[model samples]
Target: MHPPTWLTAFLDLPADEFDAAVAFWQAVTGYSLSAYRGEREEFATLLPAAGDAFLRVQSVESGPAGVHLDLHAPDQVFEVRRSPGGLAYCLVSGTESERPAPTTWEDGNRSQVDQVCIDIPPALWDDECAFWASATGWELVQGGRPEFRRLRRPARQPLNILLQRLDEPDGPVRAHLDLSADDRAAEVRRHERLGAQVDRVHEGWTVMRPPAGPVYCVTGRVPSADPT
Candidate 1:
């Protein structure tokens, strides 16, 4: 009702978070899979009496890795393009969220960001957007805003995630996590040569500050990959 859903997938990653975690864990422990592979490098979907719950989805090259995620509705195996640095797909949870609200990492570790969020609810936003279009690698960024369905991100890390309004409805999580750094675009141009601002025109990332708020810093996006 306020701001939870595992702190909105640990700050960001919604927009189709693995189709809201494999269509709500296969409609609550029904189990199902098979239908993923444009190339296939990673895949997961299980319930096993609702315990070892699974939902992986991997296969990156031109996209994916910032903790990849994708979820929206009906239509699987294809059609999830938008994250070409525009970033969006992050967060999924209908009700399962009891781990968030915590942070502290400049190398010290001590984390939480809700351990990377996911909560479902909103009527399972169309099979959780087909398990977030195969766990994000499905690619898809630069979305819309015909008012409000959800979109408030710097891709988490001090940033907040909210998009309530869509008729409102909640309940479903089970588990989730995505936070990333995989050498993001040379860290977004090394934060635009150190000043920070790398926009790249539209559907982009990198907007540093650090003094304490507004930080999506990956400027020039990493290069050799190593948030160290």
Candidate 2:
């Protein structure tokens, strides 16, 4: 199959915590929750007020809470597969074209869940990066930092793709959401007020554990900046 033209990020939550996770995500992103779908109502999309949806949530029957991606390629029937680095992803079809705007919080600071970061073991980094670049047909931009690489996404697409080489030698690849914030500290405080906790602080980003979902990061990147 040809490379995917569009993609949607899925926040896979444990079955018991699904409702709470959805609520937390909605408050953080300012997105409306779509009606739940799938047998047993296991799926839902987070609807942006101004753009086509690009983020979804799944109430998984099994497996720990984590994130995944659905690559939207033409003519592809739904299928699940693992990348070279073992990150789980789906192949599906979609026509999402309008990118959503960054959410402005009550304090005037802005943030957007603009990227999905794939954490890859050091040994598999090269192969994993190549797999994603070929799979998505996006330009792979090498990062200045040795540990990171980026896939340049189309402006109309809602999320950018980033591959991070982990210090570990080998392990399953994992994915997480990344929010670009206009004021990093302010955004962190806002999320904290919503029940999230700071996991760790880095030089340009802070890791956080939302009250109900997988851990993610709040980065110092400007919400309006091009996500290269």
Candidate 3:
């Protein structure tokens, strides 16, 4: 089954400048915070009604702070800790967290979507398709697939969203998705139960696959370190 649409995340800067940086969003989107961290936090809410979009300011880190993803929620809370009024993130707070593969759903509003597809090596086509399908229990495009494309919409999300047939795994791919496991063993066992294949092992970084064209990477690091 696909993951429920709820929250979305954006990263690239440090926590210190979030309040200041959001000025750009405020200027462009023309929408400002109604709730959330307000003027003192790294992340703030655009509207309490949506309650899922977040702007996470990466702190002390440099060079592509990591991923920018959206999560869905009716509760209207997407936690990011690292700013003026820093409260530990729920995921980082050692609270019960659910392990989810990249998931999405269609609310019939394409403009409202926060997830997108990226390119992958063409050779990974079948494997990537197979892997994601089995892992999330979703279906791949039956045919007429695009080359190096990104697909969204929960009703239709490609396991390997993009495909481009290149040399063996280049650097970490342009961008990669994140997966968090409650604990290392639990992460491994749960993914394993879902038919995921672990390719590399680390105290925290764990690369795995559901079936596979391109190997999907996951990290079972501590709560705060678990970037997804």
Top lDDT model = 2
| 187: Cα error in model 2, Å | 0.3
| Per-structure clash totals for the candidates | 72, 0, 27
C-alpha-based local distance difference test score of model 1: 0.32
Native-referenced Cα lDDT, model 2: 0.88
Ranking by lDDT: 2, 3, 1
- Residues 37-129 of candidate 1 have per-residue lDDT tens digits of 444423543323222222334333443223333332222332333332233444333343222222222432222111223334556654544
Better of 1 and 3 by lDDT: 3
- Model 3 residue 199 distance off true place after TM-score fit, in angstroms: 36
Q: Model 2, range 117-146, lDDT digits (tens) per residue?
A: 999998888899999998888999987588
Who wins the TM-score comparison?
2
Model 3 segments more than 4 A misplaced: 5-7, 15-21, 34-40, 48-63, 70-114, 119-136, 142-145, 149-152, 155-169, 174-228
Q: How would you order the candidates by TM-score, starting with the best?
A: 2, 3, 1
The whole-model C-alpha lDDT of candidate 3 against the native structure comes to 0.37
Q: Candidate 2, which ten residues in sequence have the lowest lDDT sum?
A: 219-228
Name the regions of candidate 1 deviating beyond 4 angstroms: 1-38, 46-54, 62-64, 75-78, 83-85, 88-228
Angstrom error at residue 101, model 3: 26
Please, what is the whole-model Cα lDDT of each candidate in the order they appear? 0.32, 0.88, 0.37
